[model samples]
Target: MSTDAERLGWAEQAAEALTEAGYRRGGVRSAIVALLDEQSCALSAVEIGEALAERGRRASRASVYRVMEELERIGLLARVEVGQGIVRYEPLREGPGHHHHLVCERCGRLEPFTDDGVERAIQRLSERLPLEVSEHEIVIRGACRSCAD
Candidate 1:
């Protein structure tokens, strides 16, 4: 998990990058960035719009998707798909953003997980492989604790 400070730092960096990329600052974009900063898990464009509305910040779903697409293009956001045609977005930080997902196929609950052993194994595998691995994501699907009953 990322600390509030880290998330805020990333949000600032994202806003700067967008500015540098010539994306004019607007209410929707700024609101989206602020909303994303508070999230520990990925959210879909629809969810983002809903969240903004719930917070008294109005943002159109189309605008949310446009901003998300721009962020993804700039490498500030990562796309997460946990099956069932559901796609979500999360910030891509330098360190803590790197982790895998624990998906509950039964309830569609998604959670983040990290392990030093998994990281070491990936490093070893990368050392053995011929190609360069820029990134990787592992999604383990099973019933979450609640659904296990």
Candidate 2:
């Protein structure tokens, strides 16, 4: 879990980036970014709106989706598909360092994981291939412990 200070720092950095990109920082946009920054897993637009409502913040579903799209445009968010045609959004970390997801197909659970071996393999593959791989995401789908039982 991220400390409140860390979450605030992320939100501040996002605000600065948005302002630098000639975008006005509004309540809905800020809230959406803050929520994404504090999250460890991706969330759908519907989930985002529900979370905001739980926190006493209100935004139309369309507005939330639009803000998410804008955030993605600014390189602050990435769209990840766990499975089952569900599109989710997560915060994009800086530079080439990022993690992958382990998704439970039976229960729609997403878990973030990092592995040095996988990273090295990806780097090697990128070197051997014609394309330069700056970033990558690998989603492994299976059943969770509970679901498998």
Candidate 3:
């Protein structure tokens, strides 16, 4: 999750990039970008469409897919594959908004968690290994509290 300011900042940055790339800054793409920017976790295209419908904004499935692809191509979105052929997309960012997912296998809930210990361990492992770690994603899976209960 990101702060309100950070979310807005991301939206602004994405909008600017789209404009600079000869893309217009409105319609379904604008709406999707704004909605995704405010999200705490990655969302599937179905989820995005449902959300937009709930907000009285209509976007077709094809349009949503198109915009998502465009944003990803421009480096504004990242794809997260949470197994079971399910894929989601989140804002691609760095710094304070960075975190990993806690996936609930039972309920399919995705939660974000940040741990300095895990980060430090990764750093140490990278140093010990021969490979340079350019990026990483850690997804912890289990039943969430409610599902467990």
Best by lDDT: 3
Q: Give one digit per residue, the lDDT tens place, for model 3 in 1-149.
A: 46788888899999999999889978999999989988878999999999999999999999999999999898888787766777799997776788889888877788888999998898889998878867778889898999999
Which pairs of residues collide in model 3? none
Query: Can you give the lDDT of residue 25 in candidate 2?
Result: 82
Number of colliding residue pairs in each model: 0, 0, 0
lDDT of 3: 0.87
Order the numbered candidates by TM-score, best leading: 1, 3, 2
In candidate 3, stretches whose alpha carbon ends up further than 4 angstroms from where it belongs are: 124-134, 143-149
Candidate 2 lDDT tens digits, 1-149? 55666666667878998999888987899889878877877899999999999999999999998898888888777787867787799877643235788889887888888888998898889899887766677888899999999
Model 1 whole-model lDDT (C-alpha atoms) = 0.84
* Tens-digit lDDT string for candidate 1 (1-149): 67777888988998899999999886888888888888877898879989989889887777788888999998888888867888888887557757778988887788988888998898899988998977777888899999999
Better of 2 and 3 by lDDT: 3
For every model shown, what is its TM-score relative to the native structure?
0.85, 0.81, 0.81
Worst 10 residues of 1 by lDDT: 91-100
